[model samples]
Structure formats: C-alpha cells, structure tokens
Target: MTDTPSDPLKTTPLHARHLAHGARMVPFGGWDMPVEYSGITDEHMAVRTRVGLFDVSHMGQLELAGPDALAAVQHVSSNDASRLKVGQIHYSALMSPEGTFVDDLLVYRMADEHFLLVVNAGNIPADFDYIRSQVAGFADVDLVDSSARYALVALQGPAAARVLQPLTGADLSGLKYYWFTHGEVAGIRGMISRTGYTGEDGFEIFVPPADADRLWLALLEAGAGEGIVPAGLGARDTLRLEAGMRLHGNDIDRGTTPVEADLSWIVGWHKDAFLGREVVLRQREEGTARRLVGFEMVDRGIARHGYPVLVDAAPVGIVTSGTQTPYLKKAIGMAYVPTGAAEPGQTISIDVRGRPLRATVVPLPFYKRSRS
Candidate 1:
C-alpha cells in the first residue's frame, strides 16, 4: 500500500489549473505536485519531440541587495563571480565549511548591487541561513526570500522557441545560452532565462504569483497545435536522468564533494578563498576515493536507490538514482563507486532486490539533443 496522506497536498499558484487539466498530484518535497498530466512516457516524449510546460514554483528564489552583495556572494559560493556580467547566469554549487555540498544553484547577476539565487526547494531554509551568517561585516547586504511571491514555469523541447515567440516581445533568438532577458509576456513583466534541466532547448520564466494562471493558460492555448503538453515531476526526473543531470539529495548529499560527483566544473579552482577551498584543493591534489558514474543494466531488474553495487560479487558502492528510459527502452542509473571502478566500459554488477544485474559504466549525459 502506498503511504499517501488523507490531507490534500500544498498547491502552487498554478495548482487549480493543474487539477483542471487532469494532472496526477503527488507529494514531493513537502508540496503536493503533479507527477504527470497525461502519462510519464507520453509527456517525456512530447518534450523531446515538441514542447512541454512544467510548473516549478516549488523552487526557492532569494534576492541579495546592497553594495557588498557581490563580495558576499563571492565568499560563500564556489563559482568565480568576477566573470558574471550583467544579465548573465552561472551554474554553481554552495559548499559547507567542511567542503561538502550545501546545494547546487543558479546565480543570476541582475545588476551591480543586486543578484538572484535560485535554489532547490528542500534546501531553501538551510541555504538562506548559511548565506545570512556568512555575510557578517558585509553591511548593507539585505537578503530577501521571494519564493512565495513569484512563480517559476519551464517551457522546454524542440518547439519551445516557436511556441513562446508569439507571447513575448523580447527577441528570443538573441538570448544566448546561460543568458536572460527582461520582457513582458501578455502584458505581464518577468525575466526569461534560456536554461533548463531536460537537456533540451527551453526557457524558464519568472513571473508574479498573481499572473501565473493567465500566463499558464496563454502558453497552453498558444501551443495547442504545436503539441505542447504539461509535464510533471515524474517525467522531469526521467528526462533529467537520461540527460545525466544530478539531483541534490539523490546524486549528491552533504557527505559528497563536488569533485567526487564529477561536478568540479562548477567549482572555481583559481579563486583565492571560498567556503570549501581547502577541502577542494586537497581533493584535487590527492584525488577522490569514490566518484559518481552512469551505468546501464545488461540484465533484467530495475536498479533503484540504495541498491548495492558489487565487484567480484562483493558490495562496493550504492545506487543513488535509477529509471527505465522511455527513449532508450533500457534500465539506467547512477551510483557512487570506488575510483578504480568509475571508468567507462567497466563491467560491474548491481544487486537489485537480491539479484545481481549486469551493468557497465558509461559516459555521462546518456542522451544529447540537437542544440541547433
């Protein structure tokens, strides 16, 4: 029996509309959210072939303002803030003093003295508090939580550009990757970022909470003929998994360092000092004990989280995330294994429900869409 609660789940600004459109609601990260509208496979395919909309209001938004805001951010974040130009965005990780990951977030430079940080839902409070405490002596820097006051919607797929072109006045084509533009959509102003988690061409729109419903309706209506469907968390997971994207708690935790997770690209090794600089530097010099890698099941059985990995029939690591790919029609997953077993084409076995399933380590980002 599933452990669903009797009480209705917390809804987003677009909750009523999601219900009206036949979304299957499920509890996720303390919020009641849609797992899918039509079907996970169908919705997943739609985003790959055409377009799909996702209500990601559960994400947290934070604002930093003041003369010392940039310096404060530089001290706390792992990314090199000096490279960020106005209207530019960067994917970075926040590390604890011990060098463990706090959360992976997107940092947007709105202006010289103002910036925005988009963080994961589960880590909002902890991230906010850690950042607040680190800003000591950095006077004039004010932190504000704007998560509840705003709505975030992601439109992703091959046809995303065409569908969104009619509704916004900004030149969608001009926005480069990791760049954003401020514009009005159906008379409502917001910022549109050309970034997504689905490994496809897409945009994430930040709008006022009160205008969320209208914007949702307009996009659906406009994309009706283009086969844009509303996707949910279920499809989002599979899509991101196939794309080799990492989830905060699943693929990485407080005990995992960015270097071990293969996310060292997000860390600024050249920077003078940051929260986890010493630990990261040590890891760089000494190498990591374990590393995250992709694996495909060569035998039957689905490998779910917490499953054991075996080397010579002896347990060596644990699975973090897994899914049956609708596109590839195969079992795939990610896990943290000893560095010696982390190479591509390495033969390994995962214990799935008491059975050993044959699998091979492979390169990340199992799927790549045509960017052009």
Candidate 2:
C-alpha cells in the first residue's frame, strides 16, 4: 500500500480560479488547495449572513452500483441502508473491524441499485482499498472511483436557494434537507444534493470536470448582487467548528471509537452485523472510557489542537480541534475528556502555550442561524 505522503498531490479543476481570487494556497491531505481568501473571519461571516461559494473538489466521490450494492454498503457502514430511498442522503460512519472510524461520509442513494459515497480527501485511497477488499465476495457489486472526473461546488447560506434556483430547471423547493435531484446547470448535467458541512441551507452540486470553471464563474456572476463571497478551507474550518461539526482526522481517528467520540447515534445497532458490531455493542453496554465535549475558553488564550486538558491539576484528556470562532468572537474547541468531566458548565483548564487557560464546558453548536 502507498503511504499518504508518498502519493502525488492532487489539484482541483478550479485551482486557477482560487489563485485569481487571491486565495492563500496550502498543502492539505496531499492536495494543493486554498486555505483562505480575503480572511477567515470575513469569509465565515459572509456565509452566515448572506451566501458563500466553496470549491470542494478535493473530496472523493465514488459510485457504487450493481445488484448487491445496497447489501455491500449496509455491511460496510454503521447506518441502516435499508431505509434510504432514491434521491435521499444519510450521514454515516465507516467503521474498522475494531469499531474505530475508517472515515465519516455522506451516502446518497441515487437510485434503487446505485449510490454515491462522498468521503474525506485524505482518506480516499485508503477508503477505496478497504471498501474494495470487503466487497470481494459480493460478486454482483461494482465500485468505481469517480473523484478525478467530477468537481463539487457548494453554494451555502440563507440566500443560497435563491441564487441556485434560477440556474436549474429542477424544483429545488421540494428537495428537502438530505435529499437530492438531478439537474442541469449552464447546460451541464449534474447531481444536486441539499447537504452542506457548514450549518446552513445549501446545495452541493457534482458536475463534470470540464464544466467546473464555467459553473463556478456563473454562480459568482449570478450571486454577485447578493453579497456572495468565495470562501476557503480556513473559513470552512471556523464555520464547521462554530456549528459543532466534526473534522475527520482531528475529531476522530483510527484510535477513537464512535461511541467515545459522541457519534454513537450514527451507529445502527438494530441492523444486521456490520464490520465492528461486537466492539460497538460492547462499548455501548459497558459505556465508553472517554467522551467528546465542547468547551469555551474563559481566559484570554486560543486553545489549539493537541493541547492538554486538566481536571484538578491532573491531565485527563486532550483537545482535538479548536479555533477562535469568527462568529462568536471567542476561543472554542472540542476535546475527548473522561465522561465524568464532560458535563456542561464544568470547569476545565487547557494548557495553552505554557499557560493554563480556564474554560467551561458548553453545549454544542456555539452558533446557530435561522433556517432559510
């Protein structure tokens, strides 16, 4: 198997547009991509208040189709696949045999016998290999890695619907959350999913790589009067953090189980056996050793990833993801602490740059916007 570092870096079809918009490019998950445009705070607020566009072509998009497609996905994921209908989508976690996370992904049931799995960019090759290996015995199933041929653009915020409705013939109003429909944008056939990572009403459009630049430029031109800004990964991070969303590598890893990461809700225990059923069931019955929780810094310091969490002056846990929230104007973070110390309002100390910063456990979703 090839290591992540040894693999050549990938570039999206919209790479030139990002550079034109003055995006600060950085290497992420073996991809040369933009980290920020304008500024993280400004771009983050634009999405919350108006609308913002994101080029997320770095994410992996794979198609699973065949007679045994449903069964294959059901066996690989913790979510119940039997409930999904055509044009519906569900958020689920892919578990290792030991019940730890392989990655968290969105599964879109495009048809009765076809599905699309949107996975994190860094985990694409590993995820593809793992899924392929598991489905070797399922002769009727076929898995195709389509990440290279498509580009995904996300139009997000309160005004997102208005900007996208005029571009497509599809009746987007009837396309409820977690649902999708096939549509045409600028004469290019595409799939539109009413899903987003940031907490907002939005649509994720999957179009051919050849039409990527055209659609991106058209969206900008259409939404130019509506305060739409081109956002980058830096702003995306702050937005998801404030919305209490999880980042794969930071908030979850191979060493952490879903139950311990406060993601047990994604596990469908009532369904038939999956890859990690025994371990998850055991964790559920006996309870997890640690739990993920949200906290807000009371002292003046930014709590960052890998910072030590202290209770009673003793190290107990470590912060996984954190940032100075652009929306809240405060330092907030998520960490894995002992269940006993995960209560909301509990006092904890985070060791920040050699100084202990006081913080209080807070309920998730530090920022909430009115649904459009």
Model 2 CA RMSD to the hidden true structure, in angstroms: 1.4
Task: Please provide, for model 1 over 1-372, each residue's C-alpha lDDT reduced to its tens digit, 9 standing for 90 to 100.
Answer: 112467445579999998899899988866789999999999999998999999999899988889988888888888987789999999888888888888889999999888899998767778888889887768889998888988999999999999999999999999998999999987789989999989889999999999999999888988999999999999999999999999988998788988899988888889898898899899989999899999999888889989999999999999999989887688999999999999999999999899988999999988999667
- The TM-score of candidate 1 is 0.96
- TM-score, per-candidate, Cα-based: 0.96, 0.97
lDDT of 2 by residue, 1-372 (tens): 233666776789999999999999998888889889889898999998889999999999877899999989988888887799998999888889998889999999988889899999988989999999988889899999999988999999889989998899999899999999998976789998999988988999999998999999989988998999999999889999998888999998888888888888788889878888999999999998789999999999999999999988888999999999887899999999999989899999999977888999998878777753
Clash count of each predicted structure: 0, 0
The lDDT, on a scale of 0 to 1, for candidate 1 is 0.90
Q: Rate the local accuracy (lDDT) of all candidates.
A: 0.90, 0.90
- Candidate 2 achieves a global lDDT of 0.90
Candidate 1 minimal-lDDT segment of 10 residues: 1-10
Top-scoring candidate (TM-score): 2
Which whole-number lDDT from 0 to 100 does residue 26 have in model 2? Answer: 91
